[model samples]
Target chain A: MRARVLVRPKAGILDPQGQAVERALPALGFDGVRNVHVGRLIELDVEDASQLPEMCEKLLANPLIEDYEIVQ
Target chain B: MRFPGSCDDVDALLAAEMVGEAEILWHGEHNLRGVDAIVVPGGFSYGDYLRPGAIARFSPVMESVMAFAREGGPVLGICNGFQILCEAGMLPGALLTNVSLQFVCRQVTVEATGASSAFTGGFAAGARLSIPVKHTTGRFYAPAAELDRLEQAGQVVLRYAPGENPNGSLRDIAGVCNETGTVMGLMPHPEHAVDPLTGSTDGLKLFQALRDHVGSLLAA
Candidate 1:
């Protein structure tokens, strides 16, 4: 199975990288874009589909700071 | 313990030796050779490829270190070591990119908060220690409930002094120990501040605390 995990900084957690991008976009004249958030996309191959959540919970994401969504 | 790309192992070893004997335990080996305690020094382990400590947590030596910590062994982690410990689930919370989005390197003042861990007991509660912090991802975060629980349990061993936090950590936490007090992680480079010529020696008391903890364990 092929898997894609979209890892995002959890709500209420500070996303400095995203803020940087948001600020840069304003500098480039693209305005009115708010709540800019940045995250990571991880693609992987798996033999068992059931293991995706475990993989994200264990390594692909940190539950304390990030949330992961699995796409197959 | 020495992981690949660990730049501070020599300094940590020397710092550890100042209080007692020390050695470098490579990440590849599973056996710990019965070391009294473990010190995971700072560095960019595995090049910090996937979130600083994501790759290095699976090293064979960490299995032993985890087991040792479970057995009430004292384990102190510094800088990148702190990141690794959090990723390994040996400690609570995670270190995040600095709010300033810049690598911070400077002297910081941290107040001891009385976890009584091997790495923190050297100072009394409210005692302030001047140490140097050097890292980009040093901001610490945990759920609000978890933070409250930690504060209640006194697990937050060291908190940056007012206006001294380099990374904007929640509650200004600079260091923390596990519930058992045997495992600890901090962003500050205590080993780097162990000498008088380096502007301060406040870090020596932490190394001395580790030695005392190990000695007590041996005598028991």
Candidate 2:
């Protein structure tokens, strides 16, 4: 099974990377960037898709800093 | 200034006194295979350039740290290591520059919330103790919603003592854990105060807890 994990910072955390991207957007001629919070995209090929949830809980994403969704 | 010249201090201290083995990975080399636990020791990695953990996050070593944590290995990040863990996306929330914009160095009291973590198992609920916090950018920031979720999930493992919120962290929080409690990051330097000669020995219990957990896991 293949799983794509979308890991994003928890709602209240400041995303410096996202902020930097937002700052550069207007200069890059794409001024529509708003509320852009950057996160990690991890794609994994797991033996079983049912393990995705456990993977998310154990390591794919940190619950304190990030929330993740597994798309299989 | 960075002290102790590497993670060896933590490793040697843990090994000699705590009955556990800690291997210090320099520059994040070598895959973290055959390791049950990991520690991102405190120091000015990459000279704290750009940001505390900013440069170190991209190191080859972090790749192994990430892989190990993904496989359910217990990981702990202290001081600068904590900043790196957040940057490496292993821990939640970002540690920003201190609100006061000063490098704080002193023994401060902390309250352990007993959030059921590998690092906090030795402490009782609502336990109060003193630990040293020495950093310039130790302020912890997270969205209110995320903080609420963390609290609701019992992930807030350590908190600053009442009226001792040195870094202006939300809810007086000093340290926290991932949902499963295998990963933890905090601003305090528990490794620094592990020895009684360092003014307070409260830090020993933290490392002892990790050692004990790893031992139990091995025995199991």
Candidate 3:
């Protein structure tokens, strides 16, 4: 099975990378883009999907500052 | 000893030992059985592949390190080690990129908020020390509720002095300890500032605190 994990900094947490991208967007002629946040996508090949949540909690995302979603 | 990424921490420890700062018996990750305290030195473990400490936390050695912390053994994580501890769920908050989107590498003053943990016990309340921080992602963040609990429980051990919070750490938190005070994670490199040759020895007090705590424990 193939699983994808999306890890994003929790809401209200400062996302410098996201902000930087937002700033650059205006110069590139992109307008009215608001609320940009940067996150990571991790893909993995595993045999069992049941253990993915455990993997997310243990390594893919930090519960304190990030929220993650698993897509199969 | 664990990885080549943070050899500077090991070099600093050796320098400290040579100066009689503390008696340290350095060992590799596999042999932490008789260790009194575990210092997870700063480094880009696993090349920081997924996240700074994300992959490294799953290393076989970390299993022993976590068990050691759970057994009330003192665990100190510096820089990348700090990142690992947070990822390991051993520390309270997570380190995010600096709000400025820059890698801050310089000396800043951090103050002791309280003398509750083995790491900060040697410093008086509000005592400030100069330490060097070098990282692109050092801003500390946690849920508001968790932050409040850390503050109330006196687990917030260190904070960047006013106007010295280089990164955008919430409440300027530079370091913190667990409720039991056996585990700690900090952004600055205390090991790098232990000698006057480095222009300051303010970082020595942190190591001194650990030595004192472990000494008292041995005596008990």
- Candidate 2 lDDT (Cα, 0 to 1): 0.77
Write down the TM-score of every candidate. 0.97, 0.71, 0.92
Task: Please give the range of 10 consecutive residues that has the lowest summed lDDT in model 3 chain B.
Answer: B19-28
Please, what are the lDDT tens digits per residue for candidate 1 over residues B146-203? 9999989878999999999999898999999999899999999999999999999999
lDDT of each: 0.92, 0.77, 0.82
Q: List the residue pairs that clash in candidate 2.
A: A12-B142, A12-B143, A13-B143, A64-B92, A65-B92, A65-B93, B28-B61
Give me the runs in candidate 3 sitting further than 4 Å from their true place.
B15-29
- DockQ (C-alpha) of model 1? 0.83
Query: What is the clash count of model 2?
Result: 7
Candidate 3 residues A1-72, lDDT tens each? 988999998887777788898999999999999989989899999999999999888777877778999999
What DockQ do the predictions score, one after another? 0.83, 0.09, 0.83
Residue B101, candidate 1: Cα error in Å is 0.5
- Model 3: lDDT equals 0.82
Tens digit per residue, CA lDDT, model 2, A1-72: 777999887775665567777888999899777999877788889888888888776556656567898888
* Fnat (0 to 1) per candidate: 0.79, 0.14, 1.00
